[model samples]
Target: MKDLSDKALFALVQDHDERAFAVLLERHSGLVYDLVYKRTRDDDDTKDILQDIFISLWNNREKIRIEESIYPYLHRSAKYAVIDLAIKNQRVTAYQSLLAKQDEPFCHPAETGLIASELQQQYEQEVARMPGTMQQIFRLSRDQQLSAREIALQLQISEQTVRNNITLALKKLRLSLGSDQLIVLLPLSLYISSALAVN
Candidate 1:
């Protein structure tokens, strides 16, 4: 098992051989960690993304085809994981920044800082009302700045499920926040619309 090639281990992994999967994870973890850490520069985020990659590998093992070393696949996956984290973090930062500035003077009365503060409270209330799992997913995305893959790995769910919950959560927020809130929030309204459209 220790000496098996990536292809060989992956073949066993497809067959549900836990030992083979463990071997593959052990053999390639350092490489993935190095790649992820270089891009992310945060140890915790690096480990989280590393877990996401292998969990992704194990989850998708049946569909994954490897002709040689899994190094290439792992490398590509690491890059994607970093990109995923960055995108999620960017979205979180943008929205949080908007929230943070809610008290700053903006435009009219309803669109004023007071209204923005009220909107922030209202948004939190809406988030609190979300279904337990969806709320957890949303918080992980917004507060912890974790990607869908990272959230899924942490929650032991599929990435698609994580994405779906996030989409639904955002939709709920849009509806609850209303167009008036959007008008007051400036950029977040635009971000929300674009995010929903893009997702």
Candidate 2:
């Protein structure tokens, strides 16, 4: 039940303190699991990603120099880990195809739903245009269902900053698509296709 800062825990870990490492894992496991679950929506995959994150942390322990709060670094690491996992699983193409199929669901709708769906599509396309980091954050938080606090812990940003960035991104989508469209588009917006080409 020791509440060590990331720095202290990291130091102990560097000194080969297995107990310290376990404590670090216990404290952050929920954050890591939540972030992974949001991205994957699979219990088994979340467990896999959780193990991967901790293993990566332990393996890289000797190489990392932590002068700042370790939360953001760990969070960013988890974010990248999920992205890497997505690539390995070959899920990116399937996900994008699913998003692209939204047009089919929207077609049956008259005026209101049609416009909402079209605007949603446009918003998704715009989200696709964003840089990789933003898209990853967006997907992890929105698609994977991680809260800003969990995201900040996983990605290491201040929760306020997470809120601000997500807000800004959502605001842009809303302005472009209208409020009605945003509701329909939120989930699809998380499907980022640009990074899939490289993987």
Candidate 3:
């Protein structure tokens, strides 16, 4: 396996040769990690994105086309993964800001209740739209009332990542729920922060 060229290793990998796959991983893992890390800059995001890249490579091995080397393909994959991550985060942030600006004072108790119900529905819908990892992180923090540290340990991720996911989740919720409805959801924010404080 060690004696095989890149093309040979890829051919073996496509043929279900685990040894070849391992060799390819070993040979290019550092390069892939560096490429992803340079784009993400955060240790946790880098690790998660790097793992996803390899998973994608393995899953799509049969479809891979390597004319000469695998470097270009891996590099492009890493770049696209990072870009997707950024776009997800940005969508969350933008939605949060837009929702924040829609804040207005409610006139009646009945109106408040109506808005709260609507916001809750919208929040659920938006959360459902999030990536699986983000959805899981958000639920653990919000529904389970877990602290960032606890959530990190449970998910086997960095506390920073847990916090980031939570932030993004809140932004997404805010965007979906709108600012006027956020006053109704104030307790939710308080609950999350309180949990964090305990941790």
lDDT (CA) per prediction = 0.74, 0.66, 0.73
Candidate 1: lDDT of 89?
80
Cα deviation at 28, candidate 2, in Å, is: 0.5
Q: Is candidate 1 or candidate 3 better by lDDT?
A: 1
Task: Rate residue 79 of model 3 by lDDT.
Answer: 87
Which pairs, if any, clash in model 1?
none
CA-only RMSD, every prediction: 11.1, 14.6, 11.7
lDDT tens digits by residue: candidate 3, 97-187: 7767876632368886786687788777888999898999888877777777788889999765776677677667777776445545544
Instruction: Estimate, for each residue in 120-162, the C-alpha lDDT of model 2 and write its tens digit.
Output: 6776787897677676677677777776566777988765466
The pairs that clash in candidate 3 are none
lDDT of candidate 2 vs native? Answer: 0.66
Q: Find the number of clashing residue pairs for candidate 2.
A: 6
Q: Which tens-of-lDDT digit does each residue in 1-199 have in candidate 1?
A: 7888989989998996767877777788887888889889998778767755776686688999988999899999988889988997898799878877888644677666676687788888898999999999988877776776678779999765875687677678778776436444423211211221212
Winning model by TM-score: 1
| 10 residues in a row with least lDDT, candidate 1 | 189-198
- Candidate 3 lDDT: 0.73
Models ranked on lDDT: 1, 3, 2
